[model samples]
Target: MIMYTAGDVRVEERPDPKIIEPTDAIIRLTATCICGSDLWPYRGVEPADHTAMGHEYVGVVEAVGDDVRNVKVGDFVVGSFVISDNTCEICRSGYQSGCVHREFVAGTIGTQAEKARIPHADGTLVPTPGQPDEDLIPSLLAASDVLGTGWYGAVAAEAGPGRTVAVVGDGAVGLMAVLAAKQLGAERIIAMSRHPDRQELARFYGATDIVEERGDAGVARVKELTDGLGAHSVVEAVGTQESTMQAINSTRPGGRLGFVGVNYDVTIPGIDLFFAGIHVEGGPAPVRRFLPELIQLIWDRKIDPGRVFDLALPLDEAAQGYKVMDERRATKVLLTL
Candidate 1:
């Protein structure tokens, strides 16, 4: 799929990508999806003009360059949205998204096509145990981005036993975070959403509480639930300034606030943040770090993150997928090849 301009996307023919480096690999995509992050460009918050779209994907390896060792051609694989040389020092420390040679795979290298060239194959791509069942494909594709991202968000917030975890957005990422919090053993999981469908999904994912307010009302409701002590961990899935502050205010002193939403216009007040006394950690998720376990969870039928994709369309209707997501008609859109 190519974005001809802001709010305009269409499937345009392009040359099949080829390996550009010895570490590169070419894969024929089986499935891909539109992300909330993609809306940043679609909504024109960021520039877009004849730009390639999409990053989340799952596929079979068609070819690999000489230096690639971990995965061979014909392997079923899933990769992080951010390309990374997982061998780098930063990656070695479990932050592959911050690798010295990191490159975002979205705008620059769109995987929403039939095939794509993946750099740092051994580091960025993780092949499945085997050819997944047809029904498992969507879950596997999700592990490439949203699932891994939400898992990272929960981990960053330190959602664990005896803790009360609150999620700040009702989008796919936020829902994933709720699932992660449950798997991580949080004592109480709070999902803040005004949408009924999302609220129902949140309950399915183990949300014990739901706050239908926003801004100060949302913060007050959280505090009320926590006995005036806010939640132990708060995951901020929305990137606006209001949501950022809402997440921060919803955390108790010395608590954790994990922000996975792509911050576009968030600017915190230095004085308030200083006195907030909370631990904050967030950014482009190091999805490669969590892909292995996430894939296993889906493979084992322990989690069904694929339920987040409510709309499915062929690659030819990529425009409709973008339209539905931009209008919030679909929580997430799956593009079938």
Candidate 2:
């Protein structure tokens, strides 16, 4: 898929991608999805002049460069949106997304097509235990981005036993954070969402409570649920001034806040953060660091993150996929080849 301009996307027959670097690999995509972040371009929040679209993908390796060793042709693989050499000091430090050699795999080359070229193949792509069944494809694709991001949010918030974790968004990432908090053994999980469908999914993902309110009222409800101390940890998955304040204010002093939302016009007040006394941390998730464990959980049927894809369409209808997601008509849209 290609975006000629804002609010415009098209499926075109482009020249097949080739291995440009010694560490490159070519993949035949089986599935890809429209991300909440993609909306930034779709809604004209960012400029897109003949740019390729999409980042989340799951596919079969068609070819690999001579330097590639970890995976070979015919291997089913998943990769993070950020390409890393995995040998840099940053990658060794468990922050592959910040590797000394890193590239965002969207604008230069996109995955929302029949084929895509991946640089740093050995370090970026993780081959699955085997070719997953059709039913597992969406879940595997989720692991490529959203699931890993959500897991990172929970971990960054320090969710664990005896802690009360609160999630401040109902998108795919927030719902998955609820799952992560549950898996991490949080004593209680509170999901803030007014949408009934998402609230039900949050409960299924182990949320112990739901706050239908927003702004100050929502923060008050969170405090009430946590005995006025606020939550021990808060995951901010919606990037807006309102959501950011809601997450920070809903946390107890000294509590940790993990913000994974892609900020648009949101800004953090220095004074409020200093006075709140909350530890804040978040950025582009180092998904490569969590891919192995997350892939295993999906393979073992321990989690079903694919439920986030409420709409699935063929790759040809890429425009419609973007449309539904932009309108909030679908939690997520999956494009099948």
lDDT by residue for model 2 over 1-337, one digit each (tens)?
9999999999999999999998999999999999999889888999999999988889999999999999999999999999999998999999999998899987877999899999999989999999898899999999999999999999999999999999999999999999999999999999999999999999999999999999999999999998899999999999999999999999999999999999889988999999999999898989999999999999999999999899999999999989989899999999999
The global Cα lDDT (0 to 1) of model 1 is 0.95
TM-score each candidate: 0.99, 0.99
lDDT of 2: 0.94
In order, the Cα lDDT scores of the candidates are: 0.95, 0.94
Clashing pairs in 1: none
Cα TM-score of candidate 2:
0.99
The RMSD of every model to the true structure, in order and in angstroms, is 0.6, 0.8
Model 1, TM vs. native:
0.99
Residue 277 shift from truth in candidate 1, angstroms? 0.3
lDDT of model 1 at position 159: 100
